[model samples]
Target: MNIKELPFEHVTVKALDIFNGYEISFVIENQTFHFLIGKSEELLPLNIKHYFKNQEHCNICQKMIFPTPFGQQPCLPLQKDMKDLLSHLRKTYVVLT
Candidate 1:
């Protein structure tokens, strides 16, 4: 299914903590979209809930950097939209999972 086809207002993103940087996790009902952003480990809690609140100015970029055997190549531009969402934030490895 296309991310664009999904209800935009129903789409929600969350922040998860990783070793080197932060990971932004998004969900559309049961469907999940995960992206990793490079950032200093010092940024605790990552406060993704707040970041997504103002995702309009976001420009975070993502790639198929991770090995996802079970993952299908998403044609949905949600990743790009997400990149745009994190545009103002620090640069990081945005990997869609």
Candidate 2:
């Protein structure tokens, strides 16, 4: 299915009092993916599709977050959401051409 067909949404944009510009959230499939955006054109993926039930370790934030992979791309909106993520990331950060 196409990305537009997926149930995607920009949940919120919070300052979060961090050095970065803001913490943006995109909700897809009941999962909240976070991104750190700077004042300029800087962006980093805090976590994507995190699985909190397991309470695993996250490499990015050094927190107990498990970034689960969107397996079986064709069956669901996994691939579409991943692709849409880049577009939002670009809006928050500089997409190096």
Worst 10 residues of 1 by lDDT: 49-58
Residues 1-97, model 1: lDDT tens digits: 2333443323333454545555655544333444455556344322232223221222222333222333334423454455444542233323323
Winning candidate number (TM-score)? 2
TM-score of 1: 0.35
Cα miss at 68, model 1 (Å)?
A: 6.9
In the predicted model 2, the residue pairs found to clash are none
Report the Cα lDDT for candidate 2. 0.46
Worst 10 residues of 2 by lDDT: 71-80
Q: Write the per-residue lDDT of candidate 2 for residues 1-97, one digit (tens) a residue.
A: 3544445566566775757566555555554555544555644433334433344443323455444453201212332354465564556533432
